[model samples]
Target: MTELGKRIVNILQKKSSWESDKERLLKEIQQMEDLDILQDVWTRYERVQKNPDISGTRNDPNSLLAYYLDITKEKPEEEFKNEKRRTYGRDGWPDIDMDFCDDRRHEIVNFLVGKYGRSRVASIGTVQTLKSKAELRRVIKALDPEKSINYTAKKPDQSGNFALQNEILGTLPKILKKRDGTLLKNLQEVYNEFNEFAAYMRKYPQVFETAKRMEGNISSSGIHPGGIILSPVDLSTLCPLHTTRGTNEDGQAGASKAMVTQFTMQDVESLGLIKIDVLGVSTLTTIDFATKLVKNNYGIDIDLSDLPLDDPLVLELYNSGKTDGIFQCEEAGMKQALQQIQINSFDDLMLAVAMYRPGPKDYIPQIAKRKQNPNLVQYAHPIVEKHTKSTYGIIVYQESAMHIFVELAGLTPTEGYTFIKGAAKKKPELFMSMKARFIKGASKISNKQVAESVWRQMEPFQGYAFCAGHSYAYAYLSWKTAYLKAHYPVEFICARLTEKSRRRKTDIVYKYEQDAIKNFGITIHPADLNRSKLTYIKIGEKDLLRPLLIKDVGDKAAEEIIRCQPFDPDDLLYSFGMKVGGAVNTKIVEVLASAKMFGNIPKPKVLSIFEAIKAGRQKSKGRQTGNLKKGIKGTVKRRKKTLDLDF
Candidate 1:
């Protein structure tokens, strides 16, 4: 083992006891003060030990060590005083502030498993419930004993057999809308418009009843996309464990057979298991690759966390609707909204992400108008203004609602958080109970009339809302990505292409390529067998597409081709096949040749050379087989003659 590895192991082994190990570990870590990285680790470890409830640490040695080593170092506490945030769950879990790349995130996860043992650390599972449409279809299938209704229609024309049910269920919006074109206004209005469909529904009322009963029922169980739970003891002692096979967001099967808790995230959390979101974000991967490219190609090292959040070029890119690959700001609607908002500050970016959802989306125009004319923005009361001023007097975030409850309603921070959580989750009982308490409390601080208006303002937040801290975290990443794209277009585009090239359809990468070439004036060279790596690479001012992006070239073959570069066609084929331990087929060579990857070599010539190499290998194999057969026959004859003589 390396010196560092041995030192780490030694530090871990000097444990006095389970409860006393913190002090021992800190003392041992302090001895390694000369190692700056270990000193940083010791600092974080000391902080975590001092405050066991520090959000994200969970007091587990593994969690503390991972947080200290992998998480991005934060600035002093005073720097973050202006932007206060909340931690909803137990302290010491991963959040957006960590800035972990996909690989680093997985590395931390693996470290947890190694530290706690696989049986004690497992990813949390989630239960997928049946939605309205799925429940309706299932109930219809069960009700129709003769299978008369063909509800699974691909087109409107195919709905002739079950037009009434299909049209009503399929055409109706997921969230009921009023005649005035506002969502969640009056749900009954949706059923009132079903003229003929009403008759069909009345005839089969049992179907509707069964569907309602089945809706929201657990349909299947799968591993949570990111949540990982660490048990204080063996996980099997708390919950049942099972192996689930499925792909993650990256469409990878490495975690297909990962052991997961049979219980859902809520179940594990309710059981007091410490859970952390170990999400694998492709944007972070893109940023990592982009920064590496910038450093290698331009000899410039970039610290994304330290990037200027108010760069004019980055804001201009957002305002000009040039955010095709920016995180969270790439959607067409988001881009259009950015053109109106003209993001100038980090707060604007935070509001943009927080307000781009369904409920808050409707208020975009009002927010934009307020941004354009600040005099038009108004609050129900001065207290409400304190919280809403940041969002242009608009309740664009859940934090705004929480602040309203705290400032206007005179509720404690904990109560305000509860109210916001209940409202965001649409918990009718908790929401109504909190509303009554809020009104009573507000009557003491502010008038009931103004309080009622403030309450109404917060009502829309129930539809959709995001935590202020989470929004800020995402906006920070979005700004970082935008900054990179604006200043380092070639590197950013190459990184985006590299990350997105793994998808089945290259449409996203293709669109990025078009923008890079047309908008950014970055030349995209075709994949070169000699120059192209496994991923897109920046060469001077031009970006070379990866050979793996070409059709019919698998990653293994591409790696082989890239490794056996600087060789002629015949030698290249021979070396590639020998290194890969497989045949270098003519089809791959033809693909490379067609892509103009072989310099001036024609496709026909490349194919001919490959075929000649294949023929020579076949001839050699035939000769070896013939000699082996002749030798075996002679040995058999000699053995028979010797046996006869012996007899």
Candidate 2:
């Protein structure tokens, strides 16, 4: 067996408490001559050890043997299917699965705290600084010293009696501008204008000097949303720590506090401390909830990791531009790009992901055209062909740039990486020096003319590029979400609604509801007192909108109302006021009644019933207090409630 295989087998043996049969299986694996077969067996063994319940062979000896033999029976390509690449950087966090729910992300931080001790793990801090606009506004305010300042200038006209009057401050770059003029392009231009007002401002150079000093200066410190630093020793030993107050989803400060580093992420890295980003991704939470709903409603236990890459329904959805909720593809621009590209494969999806950025977005039409007519595609040179063939003779990734430098110019991997980085930064000196070295090296292999032509073709990509590996990881997630939405539309929509509702993103929730109903033929049932849950739920064939979505009905009210089921108007008012202890109130009843939540009763009738209940309760309380004052203490039987009030 290979060294990796041996280590895996040893670990599995220790984990599974090896028996005689396992030992024999390990010996069989070790004796195998074919490395491919050995690797397959080791992978299956590892999977079995990690999750025995999902494995075909949990504890049965014959089943385990059959499973190993079955995987090896196929050809090498079929036996070892290449999974989509998940890229990781210098940090330890896995980039692919970092999009966890907020609570789960916090739970992970808490887990690290429990493992490493609280004093060793803390969140990283960030410095907020002034930007160009703010700096300009401040400088202008300081220089003018007026809330609203208007300055006018006159230009000699053909008829000198009526000269053209131009408002300088009122018609400045932001406030207004001449349609044909590019004079006031930016604040710097305003400060350098040749006009008299600008010359007047030049007298007060201190204002500009003060603004320049304040610009880019640290304004305040805040916690990095996802970056967490863990040290081997107490974090205080490395950097200063301060307690920062945290806000809830509504932006209100809460009692929760977090220990944050005085140094930012870059400073922490310079100190050699480990910083990992624990990002919160609502899509992962959506997927989790969708899977549960699918299993609960359809009895299909989906394993998102093992989904097929080429599902016709999913491909159809992508081709049709129905990717409203797919990860990274939900943006309107990305959706339009998908429709234009007419994706037929996962590779097309990866290309779309990489090419949808600001700089690369200009190349989308060319890419789509080439994809439509493969005959139009051509490579610059033979070496270029090798690296650019995957992207149809176009540079779509940074890796492609590196490969081109390494293959055509004969640059070392380190040198190639440096060349790409320098090109990306637009460092003219570094780029020219590297260009000379590349041409010289290429002359040794081919002609310098061919190398120059290739370099010209790669120039545009230097501005912006995506790593193909990261794009593939994103494409993998996009494909999974697309697959789930295409197959289980109802469950996916319900999960999506629940997710957006929890985040209080009413617009997104409403959009999903409209799309589900209009596009997918899914019915949305209104929040019913007896039926709706606290969150959107999938009934037999329809989705029940959450009661919390109703205006004036808070989450606590919805939960209590859902808990106390089968309520008439009387019970609802009693529960709101007395039974559930004011968890639901008059406002909630009025909103629910307006939403047609109280059976067949109208809002007017529901209000009247609520008023009657209030009056009866008041009278009963007064009588009880009066009787107690007269020393006539006896139990009074309360009236049984019913929903029989006239409009």
Candidate 3:
């Protein structure tokens, strides 16, 4: 036998403790390998776990093997079963399967829920089981007239649908338990689960929080669309973690935040993983989409790729700080910040990109004064003047470190770049090695003191150090978004509002709607099946696009609404004869109607959105609730003139 097989046999013999036959254990292992199940069996075997033994053998490996296969085989069947049930309506309201699937059976859902808490499990939006449980629990609590009331119930203003579901689920102990409601245990109560998940969080908080925040949570208010999931395994297997996502989907996956590219260097080495930043940039998409419209509708394919950097109008917009509708500059505070910073050129945009964040935002005012008056800009050393003159003597770009290395340490351009990336990733060991190499390789005066000063400066610079190329690329995008916001604001806000509420609660969505209404003075619409464009589409009658286009609703819903336009369906999946709407799609439609998108179509359709309620139960179809849910609407006089394209 091969040494590997011999070792396996030897280990099995030792585990049996001379009572169990060696040949029997070896045969089991061989059988497992032959069935392509050795890895999973070994993986579980190596992992110590506690559970009631039902197979009547504590040390018998065969029981474990059987359990492993049973669970694994159960996984894909569950997945496909859910997948096969969805029905796509013509109006884009595709019936998403409200079911959870696991690749491995081994009580994976239970283990994950026990480890992460059911609420978090549901929040990630990946699993339907956890979502069902959480919703069931939520309803039981919500409608318990004896317990509490945060918001009024939709129907009869007396009975909450969630409350009713809670009652139904409370009795489910018998229905669910193979014994007593399948021994209904909250994943949290299953071995003190949420705390266990929290412990795991404590064990790997940086990675956990980073991974969690990157858009997988279905319960999360953020967008984790494209049916693509960026899981912890992929993250662990990829790059070192960082602060944030890029402006859109694909770019949202990887780490290190803005301006960093896939170019491998000292940063990746220090972080112990490849450093590839997938920037979640939506402005790029919006710009591309808008440009396509401009090309097809207006006959000018204004190539942003070839557009000259120094446009007077673009500069004037940047200089004025009317960045309200601008991509990076939409926040009122950002506008105030820009006015303080007095951005003038492409280089100014670069600095603006870096200084906007929490870490380096303090420098904005000082740099603003410097930019407004050239004489005020101070230089720590000649290197500062040399490197930062483009950004008005401010160290915004990570390139400053490279510049310092070249000017002071006498290193090559390439080596300086590597050193900067290393420092930025907070890799002290790699920095030390780079320091040694630089010290050893220097041809002329390599005074340790001066080199040490450069190193000290690089320390603060690393945390705030954004890639120069990324800033430049993003500055262009930021400026473009700002331009659209400023010039075509109606179109801009419509798109911006529909980005879906990323906060944990529906109230966050409310807050965003309020912001759009109060701060930006935009007319809000309700989510309606008829009036709202599938996604946020710029209506010919209005200067703005529709918020329905937000990733919250897909082209499926939009197409449904558009294609079924004038063929208004009351509830989601009405075409499919379903009472309860698709979970997310129903919400988006309701939101669009609330925004008043359906106001112009018909009186029945234009009824205030507060009238809409998700009155149903999410069941084996993922915990759903339904009943005549309702809300109040403030009276607003309709304008005689319809909002039309002003441009």
Tell me the whole-model lDDT of each prediction, alpha carbons only: 0.65, 0.64, 0.45
TM-score of each: 0.75, 0.74, 0.44
Q: State each candidate's clash count.
A: 6, 0, 71
* Model 1 TM: 0.75
What are the per-residue Cα lDDT tens digits for candidate 1 across 610-644? 45444445445646644543443344354443221
lDDT of 1 at 401: 76
Which number leads on TM-score? 1
Q: Please write out the lDDT profile of model 3 over residues 554-598, one tens digit for every residue.
A: 555555556555433443332221332354354555545554454
Worst 10 residues of 1 by lDDT: 75-84
Per-residue error for 67 in candidate 1, Å, reads 12
What is the Cα root-mean-square deviation between model 2 and the actual structure?
Answer: 10.1
Q: Model 3, residue 197: displacement in angstroms?
A: 22
Q: Give the deviation of candidate 1 from the true structure as CA RMSD.
A: 11.0
When 2 and 3 are scored with TM-score, the better candidate is: 2
Question: Candidate 1 regions off by >4 Å?
Answer: 1-99, 136-198, 201-217, 245-257, 569-612, 622-647
Which regions of candidate 2 deviate over 4 angstroms? 1-97, 139-144, 147-209, 247-255, 423-433, 569-578, 599-647
